[model samples]
Target: MAPVSLKKLVKRYGALEVVHGIDLEVKDREFVALVGPSGCGKSTTLRMIAGLEDVSGGTIEIGDNVVNDLPPRARNISMVFQSYALYPHMTVGENMGFSLKIAGRPPEEIKEKVADAAAILDLTHLLERRPSQLSGGQRQRVAMGRAIVRRPDVFLFDEPLSNLDAKLRTQVRTEIKKLHARMQATMIYVTHDQVEAMTLSDRIVIMRDGHIEQVGTPEEVFNRPLTKFVAGFIGSPPMNMDDVTVADGKLVFASGATLPIPPKFRQSLTSGQKLTFGLRPDDFFPTGHGLNSGDAEAVAELELPVSITEPLGNETLVFVGFNGRDWVSRMLNPRPLPSGQSIKMSFDLSQAHLFDLTTGKSLVA
Candidate 1:
């Protein structure tokens, strides 16, 4: 019953407003991630929920209580930051149990809580080690262990893995996922990394310029983005975008390339309307090499020139010249594609996206 409700949340720094009238509900035991580029107010929103920042307007409720005016400790939540915030001189056990110790909890109770959290995070062996002696991942786990021992109603993580190396980030991400499953606690994570938001959250809140752009499950945001900004921001290497216009019942690119109007939008789009066409890198494949080979009704073929190829072990990313831009394509079967080579590529229009140029809203529906 530890659901969190944010009602028309707003934040302002004197004369400047940052987070505007954003509302969200985080279900009990659900993991929701707040994600957006810098200055989008994701962090400010999270801080408001944690009672770390004062809400300029709106109400924040935890479970059944209005926590807007409550202090961070009174909100009954724990936060993990990018800085780990561990005491360098204190041993892991001491650091993890320090909050309880400060609250006048008995030594025996603190020990039990610390031991339990340590075991859950696989840090029992490192309890005696100081932060200075631990690896980056270990320090983060200790930081998480500190939060777990509090047994708070909600957990807030602010880009907790941004400092880790690539390999370590992947490993810790898996560990955090496991931790979430084991605890089943309601959590709200703030991060700029869409990949982290996709992998860790049950739902994602995408924000921009003090406003929320979209809120949906990772699949919904990735496969059916509501706006052009979200379609381009949520994917790795992102979705390709090109300016286009409706002419003669066809989608004509500014570079003079043309694609037949997708049947789904033919009735809604008027002639002379401008749009931003979008296609994911994975949806564009070399001929006979697409993931959906059996589905060819919406497939369009184009002989495009390659600009560069990046080999990533099991797959290669082919950068092809399209509409006078370098469009990336993910090739499943690994192969060396020479630059300046012309290759037949397939565009899966079945998965294509179109946004109104004037509004940036999806053209569909």
Candidate 2:
């Protein structure tokens, strides 16, 4: 396995720069995921590493050697794409061993490698079946098996499970994780799905506008987002960001409501500070320890009208309007609640996040 590094990498088309001076390091045997919305240059970065795209600047290093001038065949990297790209007419075993055969390896060597990959991917029994005879998940495994047979220094996965159904995608995710564990190979994966990134990555690179927003573990990104975009984007149901201002050394939202700020945040506040207050839905509870007690710092309470309720089997998702903005909160064992009715909601003050209204930087120290 090899450690991959990109130094000040830049990609451009004519005069328009898409990827602007991005640097990344994937340690040997590390599973790193590049996650973001479309057009964030993640796919471009992966393609550049695969030698499929021309890099406008910087160098790509596999181990200690610079591979900027290398071709796809010389890069010693294997890529499993969103589409499995399996040959439809070929049997699973044939498809898996095709690369080896084309390279004129001995028949015995090809058979041994193919058998090993099939066992690793649990496709031993399905080796003789054609692509049309296999399920989506099976085809994905075959694509991965093809990559594994080559034993490339680095494995690049580009949303390999996106084509599968929801249940199949979940199943395949576990399988892929197990494969990585057993192989302990260097991997760099790209996806727009946050759930995939959260579950699969040891470290996730969050990108926006061709720039890295944050790079951290799933828990760090979820529990302690550094930017307003990250705070709102990485979570399910998204974080509620209320436009607030510093009033009398306290954070006040719309409807003349006040929530106390930790002293650590006060140092970064503007004179007539306009900020965005962030609260994750998971942090709010139907019942909390403390309610609003003006001068003393405590959990802030706000009354909001229930706008909609979505029952999600295990839990109910309740949507409400507060401070002229909509917020979604997850509730356990939630019975159906009528819309247009008012209910009191309390937020955990200790779990709150604050961001600069203009700069979008976090106010938390």
Candidate 3:
């Protein structure tokens, strides 16, 4: 079934280790993304999976077989790199079939496989065009077609869409999703973009400083982040956070603002405990502009002066001065409000998050 397993994988350059013996499992035909910021060792882990990097310790298995000693070609995995890696002089069809030709496959077999892959990737019409003649999106499709022709058990993509513009990146991302569905091949994609990871992957592995921070489905990580770093990283505008201390069953901010602790976390907290209070823009909004309809008991109302506003057609992002800082709040079906105007804001404490100041871990439990 080609389920890939990595047990205590490690990578080191001399004595300095870059991958800190992380463990992960990819189910057969599932799409998993390894994502993090730059220098997070995500690309390095993907390289090890493709047999392009040597494993310093532990075992890597594809299905039931150990492939640590196997060469790239023998691992039965296809990798599409960040660069298209196409030959300047060769046509798209030639580039797609080059691997098969080098393997001494019959001319008819190579042609058939390449033609099939080209049709699947909508590159049949551009088969004769060289890489230089195609647009960025078309060139990326050709790169994917090359990998498809191999019919490998696993597919590896290393930031394949990062080179494209925003529009082209979205277009290519959709195509890659369709490709995975059609092939039903185990895929491991690595990228630094959180949006790409959230939209493309069935599960995401977030890494930091050579260590895995968390691994879960997009919804699991976003709605219930286990750590403060994850809560800050997974959301679009990011979760708004401020340091506070527990006092008299209330969260006291540095600016002397106080908020009642939500009922769910009241019992777990104690007076004088340091915490980082978090609330998403969606949960903190202008009184009538919020998305939540349920009557939450911990809701707080305050009139805050607006600092600025960003109108995004369907919704406006309002920056209001709260606790001595400009806290962003999402306003749906927005009405134009000039800067310095005071408006009633709602803080949904039921949707709030509390993290230990020292450990950075969620205090929900």
Q: What Cα-based lDDT does every candidate model obtain?
A: 0.92, 0.85, 0.91
Q: How far out, in Å, is residue 254 in model 3?
A: 1.3
Show where candidate 3 strays beyond 4 Å: none
| lDDT (10s digit) by residue, model 1, range 135-234 | 9999999999999998889999989999999999999999889989988899999999999999999999999999989999999999999999999999
By TM-score, the best candidate is 1
Clashing pairs in 3: none
What ranking of all candidate models by TM-score puts the best one first?
1, 3, 2
Predictions ranked by lDDT, top down? 1, 3, 2
Model 3, total clashes: 0
Clashing pairs in 2: none
TM-score of every model versus the real structure: 0.98, 0.93, 0.97
Weakest 10 consecutive residues of candidate 1 by summed lDDT: 288-297
What would the per-residue lDDT of candidate 2 be over residues 1-365, giving only the tens digit for each residue? 99999999999999999999898988999999999999999999999999999989999999898998899888778899999989999999999998889879999999999999999889999999999999889999999999889888999999888899999999989988887898889999999999998999899999889888888889999988989988987989888888888878888777786777754475666556899888888766444323232323445567778898888987777888877667888776676779998887777666788888898988763
Candidate 2: where are CA atoms >4 Å away?
Answer: 262-271, 288-297
Predictions: Cα RMSD each = 1.2, 2.8, 1.3
> Where is model 2 poorest over a 10-residue stretch in terms of lDDT?
287-296
